[model samples]
Target: MALRLAQILPPVVLLVLAIVGILLVVLPARETTKTPENMYGIVLDAGSSHTAMYIYKWPSDKQNGTGIVTQHSECKVKGRGISSYAGIRGEAAKSLEACMQEALSQIPKSRQAQTILCLGATAGMRLLDIVNSTESRRVMKEVETKLRSYPFKFKEAVILSGQAEGAYGWVTVNYLLENFVRYGFVGKWLNSGRETIGALDLGGASTQITFETAEKVEDESNLKELKLYGQTYKLYTQSFLCYGQDQFLRKLLAHLIKTQGVKSPIFHPCYPRQFNTTIKLGQDVFNSPCTKSYRPAKFDPYMNVTVVGTGDGGECLASVKKMFSFDNCTYSKCSFDGVFQPTVKGGFMAFSAFYINYNYLTRLTNISIRSSNQMANAMRLVCNMSMTEMVEKTNQMERYLKNVCAVSHFVKILLTEGYVFDEDAFPTISFQKKAGGASVGWALGYMLTMSNLVPAESLGLMKAMPSGTWTAILTLFILLLFFALGYMLLIYRARTKQDLV
Candidate 1:
């Protein structure tokens, strides 16, 4: 009986080892085949013109050091930005309700609590904070309260500094362009080793320029350092406040009113020859800090002034040029307004108002802007179009159509003169509204950093051995176990037969 038990035990042990070895190989393979759960994040961009909400998602198991975050959905909050709701309590937070509700349907209820939600107010709030800190704090608190009421894990509601905004935008641009890290053909995540592109963001109240630069940044404040996908980059970033499309227009209008004198039928060189509009001195033009210096000493706040279009392209360019001060440069190099900037190197992605104006100009004139001359020619055609011709050609609203020429020229000057992108460098600027299916902006970058979605180091594999090596070893072990079991059974059977005989 003891001999019988020993024979059976050896075969049983071999069978068990074979089963264990099979599972050791098969289970990990199964895990690798299964899809990872997805994580979600929400970012609300509250700009001066309007507020927009973006939803982003990524796999739970990140590849390399970065989450493959992509825009899941987006909602544009109706009405103006949160700052516009200032002086009216609770309205700022109320404006975000529609977008937040939309987010509820987009993100799964199960993952809502785990999902991160953040709100970043840009130059509009920054300006508001400068003008009225009390109102700014109140708006932020109200917005925070509204966000907390939702199911998501509320991160924070804060006004992003100009430097932070610029840096984050740079990240967004490069991340979308796959300049940091990319999946190689070898089924592994690899550093792209591609030259990073620059980001040129034109919003309602500010414009930001950020790029990787090896040259020494003259202004320490303009220099930013970032680590992404295990790669370090030294960046030069500068945000010019009150230089956005809307604010620049305001400044331009104020400059016109100040230069031509506040009177009926003020001639505007940028507007179309047939276009005319009525604007108030204090409310329409001088209400913001950007145009505060140009406010008339004795004009009524509600006084109406008529603005007539002269359709002069040359004068329009000259007038836009005056808005920038290129003389006082304390640094080795300056962009415009005496701000320090390294040479605009590499390709650039210009978004927001830049793309908008470019799109309108291209559609109106059927001209592609590749050089300074091309842009100038496009502006001349757009500026010369009549109000009726513009409406017919573009099929856009009169309000938007009227300002196309001015905005286009403003963009042209901002790029060629302000940012110092000369003739040769001009073609490198690609006007784009979106990249990689996501809108080009700082919101994604902000969410990425705040949520720790991007780690400094790549994620290590779960198993120390390669999957192929594990498979080969496990197969060998199983085959050996099978042979051993077969041999032991045969031996046991032979011994039983001999004993029986």
Candidate 2:
């Protein structure tokens, strides 16, 4: 009885437990430490016309926590975003390799980076084109292989989606506003009687509108409520899509004729402003002398009749007046109705006349199109304006969307559905860009945040390990433990026999 039990006991308890403990560390926590400083993180913000690369370090002391990350030091390289549309293959690899080398120069040589994470945006995610049809099942494979060719032991990259970018922007904006906005810390928006606000972010290819109010997230439970201005929008509400200035314009021109019921105009050699005119059927019909440029052989019926023009440019503004001429027409004025009319609020005209009553889209569209050009131009317009002026412009834009566009209704819908997701209810801002300029502020902020959270060594372990290997490990341990016990038992039996003899 003792021998039989002994044969099974060691394998069942000690061996099994030992094997499990090893697996707990090996399977669940397969994290391996990589060299510090040598772990390089590359963020490729691939826009339509340009690509920007930002490099970061994985610090040894980083830890996970709440609150906004502040450090942003990183090396940046141009020529990677939308311009590298052919998926990161061939020439793409060469270009990125050069960028990697250049980035290496920015960091200290004493530190070596062991892992590389390359994140691609826009084109890589949305508009990848196949190069040489002979290769892989997916286009991204080409991109993945090329990026992985880097010298680092661990090389991984991801192309972000449109929704992802919008979501990230929403998170970033809220975090920044929470830290800098007035009355932000009091969580006044969470109070039953506090005012609320909205936020909008317009990127090169997409725009996001967020309607937010504060809610009380009890330390004890998972509940929240939002307060918007005097009313509540919800916890958070937002909408993001691919409707942007350049894309909108291109699509508009592509669909003009079928939607308008007019023959396509010839391409006018004159400036865009001079092309605006009142056409007289003139009893002569086909005899009208028109430019050859605007003429399309066929019409597109799917055209969204709403036109969105860049809101910031006096030139763009001039172009709107000259081409569409909505300021003087009676049919186009007095109300925000009509597909062709331009609304006069928010210091600009509404493009999608349908959204005159939709606060989220209207407000976001206005900010997006108005400030659509570039940061420099938008900043210049407000350079001479006092704080009052800036606030007035901002508030006026808000009121215009709220009152004229009837944004409250949509905001209410989002509230009911619980889609509004701002950290707080008000618009808060920090002078990150201004203290050292926006570019430097962005860089420093990235560096500080990356250093505090990521440890370079765990990159490989994170990438490996699928599942279902535990059964094999357990069986192997049981067999080994049984063998060792059998040998010991045999020796004891042999010794007993010898003593008896």
Taken over the whole model, the C-alpha lDDT of each candidate is 0.85, 0.34
Tens digit of per-residue lDDT, candidate 2, span 1-501: 697677656645655665565565355333333423334445544454455566544443332321223323444455544334353345544545656676556655554344334545442235332223332224345546756665543333445554344334433333333322222111111222323323343333333343232433222111123321223233232223323333323322333332345543422111121222222222112111121234445434332232221222233222222222123424322111112211111111111211222333333333332222322233234322333343354565422321221122222222212222222321131112222111321222232233323122221111111134545654566666676566657766976897899
Model 1, residue 312: what's the lDDT?
93
The C-alpha stretches of model 2 lying farther than 4 A from their native spots are 1-40, 57-59, 63-84, 87-89, 114-116, 127-139, 152-155, 174-199, 210-239, 257-501
Across residues 253-358, which tens digit of lDDT does each residue of candidate 1 receive? 9999889888888899988996889998877798899998888888888889999899998898888888889888888878887888888899999998888988
Collision pairs in model 1 = none
Give all TM-scores, in the order shown: 0.85, 0.40
Error of 1 at 210 (Å): 0.1
Per-residue error (Å), model 1, residue 187? 2.1
